[model samples]
Target: MDLPGVVGTFFAANTIKRECQLLLLLREYVTSLTMACLVEDQCHSTLCDALVQLCIEMRSLDSPPALIRTDPASGFTALCNNDLLKQHRLSVRNFLRESEHGSSKKRIDLSLADKVQLLKHLQLPGVSQASAAKKFGVSTSQVSRLVKAKQQIFDQFDTGNHNRKRQRAGKEEEVGSALFLWFQQKISQGARLSGPLLKQKATELAAAEGSEFTPSDGWLSRWKSRHNIAYKKEQGEKQNADFPAAQHWRQHIIPAILQAYNKDDIFNADETGLYYRGLPDKGHCLKGDELVGGKKAMERITTLVCANMSGTEKRPLFIIGKSRQPRCFPRDPSRLPVDYGHSKNAWMTGEWFAKWLKKWDGELRCKRRRICLLVDNCSAHPSNVALTNIELKFLPPNTTSLIQPLDMGVIKTGRVTTEAD
Candidate 1:
């Protein structure tokens, strides 16, 4: 018998007997032992001594010698398991083929460059099809096909679609390019694209092109990743603003006032609703049923929050609540950091805005600064209000996100900090 057949039969017998100790020892010194078996006498006796010594070592280990799991009917399958291979001093992990690709028929996805290299090896003299397949870790039949139709493969490679199996399956590059272009245009125009929205757009485009294929969710996700498109949390939606008007206000009007007043004099005021008892409905000290039935949990307070762009000044909060004197309020509301007001629905009206504006005007008169109060063009804000040393500038309609400095983050930070307290 040949040396290869003899070695193969010996390992097959050991695997059937589940001789884990012999398997471990073989893994450690298989290369050197194979050389010795071919060149020296009495190598089998030497191997038997090594296996006996390995059994003693196995007893000391916390776990039994690792064996590959298999169906009982299939008999022992693997020559040596991963655990024994890992413990070997030589670390021959790379020498062993991966278990996933052990089958010859499995299609190996390779780049055009790699295919070219494999084909070039096949072109060399004395390289048989089987040897070339082993070298490239593919089936012998695949190697034969590549050698037979080398010219066709070269043409496919040159076209840059040789490795793109999905294109052959149904997806066209032209459709993908069109979808990517639409995505880019939408993003550039400040439109937010959610997962569902992206999938919808892809389906619409496929229908319009009269193609039966609609991109699956997985395909759309992969497309985004392939194009390096990332999803981010949108702080606010960008509405179309009157660019000419906004440009004039920022470039012409705002700059013109710098000579007359300092940065501290410029203030932005905005209103926000606070759900004061907005704790998690669950996981609190109270029972879930108690929280579900509680009135305090539903209570909300509307507050006008103000901050100067220079960050040098912050106005006292003006809170609008449904009650004139809530149970939580002190006898003297004037001592609180926040100014209190009462409303039927806890909403700020134009009348309250006018009064609040006047109150700030009196405070500003004492500060002796020429005030430029920037406000949003909301219905609550009074358009015509008489004030001393106070110039009210209403931001263009729907342009609060673009112009209001407090909307940038001041009010949001204040809310979060307050909630923490």
Candidate 2:
């Protein structure tokens, strides 16, 4: 037989299946060796030793060798000539060296949600730890640890929708629990709260509890996240709003006014500032690139809108600008689309508001109609404006953004439309 050719075929095997097949062929050949071939000649004996060492190393690539040959002559005869067997042994050694260098283990981080899902998967009847680990891309030991803590994991999941990667609890547990209870009570009372107020309250609670807890910004943020709290922009007043008064007005005062006046005769008037020439405040740019914007335009106007309930009547817009006779106006002021007024700074003044209210009241009286005009309590709107047909009622101070009809969205919609134009 061509011994060098047989050895060459075994060395050419690349994949595991091919390598195993060749190994089996080599074993069979070793078993078929005649006593004549096993003769202890120096050259043949040297070749036999090399083949035995190569087979041991190859088998050790995956698992420990079941049995190692102390006497090479007992297992195999001389299979290949000197040069061929030497080259094959060198190739096997180099392959084993590379395999050792390339092996590495990496760690995987699993979130709480993922861990819960994995626990659920482990409850299947036919699944084993090894198979579950493979399915979840984790190790068998990790799966075992999760199984040990399955009860704790399930209990944590029931607390909230906390999908954090790691489970952690606040150091000051009593303070946090007490603070959350206080937060819930305040929210139930319809009180407006801000972050600074929450942090200050937390510090006070901690001090009362005899704990040295400092409510830093980071701690406050984490506490909020754990309790699922969010921050919203307070429209008119930050924390000074009188919720009890507003609630009382809504429950008692408002119903009396509604009963006394017709829905069509209840009017709301509000003034909003308009930056007619202002550009958008936000723009998109490539990441890591500095964004440049044009200087903001200060050209502004004050517009007053009046509308009655039942959507039956809408007065013409009253626009106040800095210039009484703006160059943009037509030669005739009456040709303008809106009622034009003027102030030194384009702001509504008490005199102008009183004049406007008197004009509206005179028109209502001529038509033999009485109306209730609801306006916010601002310095410009005098409660003493004298009118026979117009009953001026001011909203409780600092509650306009919360309860005023025009502020609910009317002014915002008008501003958006003006900007679009």
Candidate 3:
């Protein structure tokens, strides 16, 4: 029996149900009063007497639940600490139980064809339910259920191709088709799906179809497994808001640029923010922690990275900061890994980009080769920079995030390598 019913029965049997109820309320009230008295530093003489009387009556009862008694002598800090520990333990246990429930395996029932074969063999005069059960490697109870639903099984066999198992009553073939179509539509729009969000969308679709569809966790889990649906980390990209613009760039602009320049001479540059001294935001933490202790390293710098399509030449990083020179920098500026630039906001500006291009031009002056430099169409990128050896080509708006070779893998890999080093 459930605990509540058992507790009620015990109280009813003892003929002190009312007194037990009163005692519980009195005990709770006394505890709160004592805690309040201690906090206020007021005399709890009357409260102590009431607590003593409640305790005596509770012990005298036929059956008494365990009561936690806290006195002012224990100190308010100790009382609060005990309460915190109790709450923490309870939360941990609940989390573990939920995890176990999600991970637990349920009995997998036989498919319709298997059930039909088992029932058909049992129908043969010589075959007993036990023999059929043994042959099918199922229990006698399962065999009995098959026998009782023999007509339904036959109907399923006749209606279905018998190649696949029958879907559950509520989960029709239509529902699966609808869900698949929804997933396709979402993917086309570049929207990501979590389990809860998917469930909510499914529920909405089912409601619109005039059918009830509240899928269990197990049902969703099995459905995904059957359909080969999986969760994957999506690459972050700026949304392609104008398809025509992107198409124009890819089909016409990029082709024209490539025709004029060799792939080795093609270079792409992009900037990304970095927290040089801090750990990644995603990491392991203790259970129930909302915030981690210790001040986080908030020091940030913007790194303008440049690379070629052939992955041959990686230019020195254009490190933008609030100061002209940070203390961490080497005394000899030319010896540093990065060419330092400064802005009030520590972000790339058109002036800095022009200056960096001029510096790069100085490096390429000896080669006498005019190179195509691909950059994003950010406000910080100069539209009218006059250079002799370099030709600036700004990518179509919003397309650089994924299309640019520097943003796609080169810069990200560079950051990871630098972090590792």
TM-score of each: 0.51, 0.49, 0.54
- Regions more than 4 Å wrong, model 3: 1-171, 189-194, 200-213, 231-235, 282-296, 419-421
- The C-alpha local distance difference test score for the whole of candidate 1 amounts to 0.61
lDDT of 3 by residue, 246-269 (tens): 778888988998999998899988
- Model 3 whole-model lDDT (C-alpha atoms): 0.62
Q: Which candidate number would show the highest lDDT if scored against the true structure?
A: 2
Weakest ten-residue segment in model 3 by summed lDDT: 7-16
- Rank ordering of all candidates by lDDT, starting from the highest: 2, 3, 1
> Order the candidates by TM-score, highest first — what do you get?
3, 1, 2
Candidates' C-alpha lDDT? 0.61, 0.67, 0.62
Overall local distance difference test of candidate 2:
0.67
- TM-score computed on alpha carbons, candidate 3: 0.54
Structure candidate 3, residue pairs in collision: none
- Give the per-residue lDDT of model 1 (tens digit) for 1-421: 1223221112211212232122322322212232111211112223234433443343244433332222111111111222333353211122223454555533544444446657887779998878766654567776777778788767656644322322232255556677778987998888778888877777777778887666787787667644546677766645666666777778877887676668888888899999887764445544445534344566888999887768888888899999989897789888788888889989998888899889888877898867888888888998888998789888887667677777777778878786773
The most accurate candidate by TM-score is: 3
